[model samples]
Target: MSEENNIPSNAPVFQIQRMYLKDLSLEQPNAPQILLEQTQPQVDINLALSAEPVAEGVFEVCVTGTVTTKVGERTLFLIEAKQAGIFEIRNVPQEQVEGILGIVCPQMIYPYLRAIVSDVCTRAGFPPVLLTEVNFQAMFEAQQAQREAAASPTLN
Candidate 1:
């Protein structure tokens, strides 16, 4: 008789342990004057993602967003927020780890980061700055391409 278990012991494992707001900062340098401006303030947003191993099979992934609103030469307000998640990943192929970290993990955590940024802006007496949906797969591909280009030697 052949005996085989339903589940494999080394099957790929991926799980989210926790998600939370890692850090947030709001700065209104020219508050009173900038607030009085009749002209619409220009909004600029920057986002960054990072992942690091925290334990044997645990990783911490973080997404940071920075929003800066400007009225002409004056700064209206700036908001920087970092959202992080603790994920457990194991038994996966080494080749797939990079994609899982750069694309999959960020996709799971980005929505919460967006909501937090918008909520903070609204509570701070400013219109909500809704973050647009991101294509992490495309981003990861672009980054990989960039790294490859950088690594390859140019012919003289």
Candidate 2:
């Protein structure tokens, strides 16, 4: 084995490259009527996670969420959120980048994203929303396996 291999290269190194809002939108369908009617608007929320490679050793992990509300047949509001974090990812093997992005980076970015989503909703005159933790490692591995499976067809 070469010195590089003998030295155990998988050391831990992670950095925050940047953080920004990739997208955001808010809408109130029945602006005047919804504002007047106050009957605890029904709320529904959904969330998703994603990551993209930006540079050789940098990747961005994003969490997006949508909130929908209705007050007795009239749309009260719609709030969408996209919070992203730029991560400086080095020392990890190329084969493991997806794992890092899917699993580790999401873990790091989730809190900030949750806070952003909650804060935004609160500022928009709604209660704060606390999103649940995501299983990025599992999601990453599943995606990797899918890609590998796609690349190499098998005989069933």
Best by TM-score: 1
Tens-digit lDDT track of model 1 for 7-104: 67777889999999999999999978778779999999999999999999899999999999999888899999999999999999877988999999
Worst 10 residues of 2 by lDDT: 1-10
Q: TM-score of predicted model 2?
A: 0.72
Clashing pairs in 2: none
Off by over 4 Å in 1: 1-6
lDDT of each: 0.93, 0.78
Candidate 1: clashing pairs of residues: none
Clash count, predicted structure 2: 0
The true-versus-predicted C-alpha distance at residue 19 of model 1, in Å, is 0.3
lDDT of 2 by residue, 10-128 (tens): 66557887888888888877877678875987888886788888887778888887878888777888888888899988886776776777777677767777787778778877777
Q: Tell me the lDDT of candidate 1.
A: 0.93
Clashes of 1: 0
Model 2 C-alpha lDDT versus the unseen true structure: 0.78
TM-score against truth, every candidate: 0.94, 0.72
